[model samples]
Target: MPLALYMLGLAVFAQGTSEFMLSGLVPDIAADLQVSLPVAGTLTSVFALGMVVGAPLTAVVGLRWCRRRALLSFLAAFVLAHVVGAITTSFGVLLATRAVGALANAGFLAVGLATAAGMVEANAKGRATSVLLGGVTLACVAGVPAGALLGQLLGWRSAFWAVALVSVPAFHAILRWVPATTSAATGRGAGPSGAGASGASGASGARAGDFRARRELRALRRPRLLVLLALGALVNGATFCTFTYLAPLVTGPAGLAEAWVPVVLALFGIGSFAGVTIAGRLSDARPMRLLVPGGLALLVGWLLFPAVVDHAIAVFALVLVQGALSFAVGSTLIARVLYEAVEAPSLGGAFATAAFNVGAAVGPSLGGAAIGAGLGHRAPLSVSALLVAAAFGTAGLALAVRRVRARRGEPAGRTLTS
Candidate 1:
C-alpha cells in the first residue's frame, strides 16, 4: 500500500477517536454537566444523526469540487469543532458541537472511502478500503482508551483537547502526502499526474449525467443491494446496542472498578483491530462467507452476554469476542456494497457510511430508552442479539433472491464478486 493510503487511515483515526471516545466519557460528562446518564448518552445519537444528514450532502459537494479541497475543508471544520468542544461548559453547547463535528466527520469518511477506492488497482480495492477503515479500528483500540484515561485523570473536556491536537498531524499528513490534482475527480487509479491510470476512462465516462442517473436508479431497483445496506445497518446496530452502554455494563454488573473501564475498552479495541485485519483478506476473497458467519457469531455472543456478565473473567472474554465478531463484518459490508453499486461510487460510499451511522444512532437511542425504562444495563445486550438476528435474516433473504434469479436463468444483478 502507498504512504498516501496510510495517511487516509490516519485521518480516519483522528475522526473516529473523536467520535467513539465518547463511549467512555459519557459518565464523566453526565456527572460534570449535572445530567442523567441516559441524557448524556444522547450525545452518541446526536453525532450519528449528524452523519445521517451530512453524508449525502458531502457526496454532492464531493462531486462538485476537487477531492483534496473537499477533504481538507471537512478536516478543518472537525478541528474547529473539537477546539470549541474542549471549552464548552453547557451540555447544550456540547451537543451542538458534537452535531457540527459529526457533519464534518461524515464528509471526511464518505469522501475518504471514495478516494481510497479511486487510489487503488481494481483488484486491490478491498485491501485499500480495509486499510482506510482500519484507522477506526485502531482508534477504538488506542484512541478511545487513551481518551478515557485522559478524561479520568484530567477532565472530560481534556479529551476533546487531545482530539483537537492530534488532528493537527493528520491535517499535515494530508497536505504533504495526499496529492492535490489527481483523485476521484479524475477517476479511479489516477494519481497526481492523472495519466497512465487504469480505469480512468470508465470513471470519466461515469461523469455523464444521464449515465450516472441510470446507474443510480438501477442500483436502487436492486433489492439485493438495498438488503445488503440493511445488513450493514443491523450489523452496526447490534454492535453499538451493547457498546453504547459498555462502561456501565462492565462496571455495574461485571463488578469491575471504574479504573478498569479503560482497560476493558482497550481489550475490545485490540480485538477489533485484529478482527478487521483478518476480515480484510476474507472480504476480498470471500465476503459472503465471512458476512454470514460473522453475523451469526455476533448473534450468539450477544445472546450469551447475560449469562457471562456476572463473572469478571467471562465478561472480559465475551467483550473481546463480541467486539471481534462485530468488527469482522466491516470490510465485508464495504466490499459488498462497492461490488454491488460499482457505477455510483460516491453514492455507494455515502450509503455505507450513512447506513452505519443510522444504526449507530438507533442503537444508543434504543439502549438509552431501555435503561430509562428500568430494564438495567444487560437489556442492551439482548437488544443487540435481536438486531444481529435481523441481519442474519436479511442476509438469508438476499441470498435466496439471488439464487432464485440464477435458477430462472435471469441475471442475479450486477455482482462484482463471485
Candidate 2:
C-alpha cells in the first residue's frame, strides 16, 4: 500500500475512537452534564445521523478542493470539536460537537476512500481500500477499549482530549505525504505535483465542473450500484444487530460471566482484523471467490447462531466465525460499490460511507425493536438471520440482473458509467 494510505488509516484511527468511545463514556457524560443516560447515549446516534447526511454533502462541496486541503480542513474541525466537547459543561453543546465531529469524520472517510483508490493501480484498489479501512477495525480492537480505560481512570473528558492529541501525528503525516493532484478534477494514479495542479479556470472549467457534478449525481441512479449499496447496508445491519447487543447476549443466554464479555468482544475484533487483512489481498483478484462462499457461510452462520446462543462454547465459536465472515463479505461489498461507480469515483466513496451509516442506524433500530417486543437475546439473533437472508436475496438479484445484461452483450462493472 501507498504511504498516503497509511496516513489516512492513521487519521481514521484518531477520529474513529470518538465513534465507539462514547459507549463507555455515557455514564460519565450523563452524570457530569446532568442529563439522563439515554440522552447521553443519543450522542452516538447523532454522530451516525450526521455522517449519513454529511457524506454526500461534503463530497459535493469538497469536489473543487485538493485532497490535502479538504482532508486537513475536516481533520482540524474534528479536533476542534473534541476540544470544545472536552471543556463544555452543557449536554447540548456536547451533542452539537458530536454532530459537527461526525460531519467532519464523514468527509474525511469519503475523501480517504477515493484518495486511497486513486493512489493505487486498478488491480490494487481492493488492497488499498482494505489498508485504509483496517484502521476502523483497529479502532474497535484497541482504540475503543483504550478510550474506555482512559475514561475510567481519569474522566470522560480525557478520552476526548486524547483523541485530539493523537491526531497531531496523523496531521503531520498527511501534510508530508498526500499529493496535490488528488482532487475530483484529477483522474487516478497521479503522482505528487505542483500545488496548483487542480486549479481550473474560465468558462470551460466551470462547464466541466458542472458536467462532473451531474455525472456524480446520476451515478446514484444505476440499478446495479443501487443494489450493491443495499447489499452493503443489509449485510452491515446484520452484523450490527449481533454487535450492538453482544454483551447482553453473552451473559443472558450464553451463560458467560461478566468478565468474559471483553474477551468475546476482543476475539470478534481479532477475527475481523484477520478477515479484512486477508480479504483485501484477494477481493480484487477474485471477489466472488470470497463473496459467494463468504456470504453463503455467513447466512448459514446466522441461521445457526440462535441454536447455539445458549452454549458458551458454541457462542464463542459462532461469534469468531461470524466476525470473520461478516467483515469479509462487508469489505467485498464496499469494494464492489467503488468498482461499479467508475464514473463517479468521488461520489462512490460518499455513497459507500452513507450506505454503511444507514446500516449502522437500521441494525440498532431493529435490534432495539426486538428487545422492546420482549423477544429476549435470541430475538436479535433471529433478526440477524433474517437480515443475512435479505442480503443473500439482494446479491442473488444483482447477479441475476447482471447475467441478463451480459446475455444482451453489455459490459460488466460499468453499472452507470454509460
| Candidate No. with top lDDT | 2
Each model's lDDT comes to 0.78, 0.83
Q: What is the TM-score of each candidate against the true structure?
A: 0.86, 0.93
- Candidate 1 per-residue C-alpha lDDT over 110-215 given as tens digits, one digit per residue, 9 for 90 to 100: 8788777777776666787888788998998888878988999999999998888877776776787565654433456445444322123455633542344445
The regions of model 2 sitting more than 4 angstroms off are 189-197, 201-210, 402-418
With candidate 2 superimposed using the best TM-score fit, by how many Å does residue 91's alpha carbon deviate from the native?
1.0
Off by over 4 Å in 1: 24-42, 87-93, 183-186, 189-221, 370-376, 407-409, 414-416
**What is the model-wide C-alpha lDDT for candidate 2?**
0.83
Model 2 is weakest, by summed lDDT over 10 consecutive residues, at: 189-198
Give me the overall lDDT of model 1. Answer: 0.78
Clashes of each: 0, 0
